[model samples]
Target: MKKSLIAVNSVAGAALLTLVAGAAILLVLMFSTDGDADADRRAFFGSLMFSTKEQADGSTAITAGVDDPVPLIVLFVVLAIALTFIQLTYRALKVHRQRLLEERGLA
Candidate 1:
């Protein structure tokens, strides 16, 4: 049972890692400008707003959600901590189960 669970978890983790890597690569590709200043400026400014328009006075007009990356960063940190805790708890439980089986002559 435990071995099967470990195998499943390993597969799932690998899949998730691959998905994240692909997403990161896609993001990099999307944001890469290849020395195009206009595209670089567009990519830099576009990620910050839901809607945007250029004014004749050379100023940005932001519609919503300007500079909102802090919350997203915080969420990722919390998620990483939670996953670490879960993995540690799983490892501890596996060790404890092994100790119990050994004491009871079941393994």
Candidate 2:
């Protein structure tokens, strides 16, 4: 059971890392003005949550169709904090367990 839990956590961590990396890539690409209109459109509007476009009068327009990204951002921040806490707790527990085993000559 413990091994399965660890495996699941590893997969989840990998998935989270992949998602963060993808988001970072998209953000970088979104700002890259490569002189390609279609590519720029795709990159800028990649996310379904919200989109921002430049207007003709040098102003930006934000179009969020009922899906606000603030809550999603907050959720991601909280999840990151919780994941850090969980990892720290797991490491501490592992060290304590090893210490206990060594003290009892079981390791």
Candidate 3:
């Protein structure tokens, strides 16, 4: 039973890691730009809510219009912590069960 629980926990942790990594990759891809002229200008103004000058390289480098990734970062951190806690709890439970079995001379 203890060995089974450890195996289950390991599988669950792997699944959780895969999910987190997929989400992170999706987020990164969504925020990536295509360098389209009109689209970039629209994104810049929409994000900044103001007009801005073009850069020396003929590109509009809007300082005020960066996408905030704080929420995503926080979500990932929470998920990782939760996964760690779950794995730890699973291992602890497995150990407790083994100890109980040993005490009863059942294993």
Candidate 4:
């Protein structure tokens, strides 16, 4: 039973790793600009608001939540941490079971 669980976990972990790698690649591609080095540098350089526009009367307007990623990336980061904790717990339990079997002389 323990061995089968470990096998299943290994398979699941591998699949998850692959999925994460693919998602990371996709994210990188998504954020990539059109061969503009200055733009790329400026993007991560500051947290300026993007909803501002200059009016013909020499005034500035600012709204909210334009290109905001905190609400989105926070979800991904929390879920990733949850998955890491679960995988670690699964591996720890598998090792504990193996040790128990070993101590019992059950191979």
Residues 27-98, candidate 3: write the lDDT tens digits.
Answer: 443455444432332232122222344667888654333354444445456665676667778779999999
Give candidate 2's TM-score: 0.42
Question: What is the C-alpha lDDT profile of model 1 across 44-100, one tens digit per residue?
Answer: 223333334566787655443324455444444555555556776889999999999
Measured by lDDT, the strongest candidate is 2
lDDT tens per residue, model 4, 1-107: 76566556655665566446445544544355343232321122122122344567876554332144453344445555566667778789988999999999997
What lDDT does the true structure give each of the candidates? Answer: 0.52, 0.56, 0.54, 0.51
| Residue 7, candidate 1: C-alpha displacement in angstroms | 19
Give the Cα error of residue 78 in candidate 3, in Å.
Answer: 0.3
Error of 1 at 50 (Å): 2.0
Ranking by TM-score: 1, 3, 2, 4
| Clashing residue pairs in candidate 2 (N, C-alpha, C atoms within 3 angstroms) | none
Model 2 bad stretches (over 4 Å): 1-66
TM-score for each predicted model, relative to the true structure: 0.43, 0.42, 0.42, 0.39
Clashes of each: 0, 0, 0, 0
* C-alpha lDDT of candidate 1 relative to the true structure: 0.52
Q: After superposition, how far is residue 21 of candidate 3 from its true place, in Å?
A: 10
Write candidate 2's Cα lDDT for 65-104 as tens digits.
Answer: 3233454455456665566568668978999999999999
Where is model 4 poorest over a 10-residue stretch in terms of lDDT?
Answer: 40-49
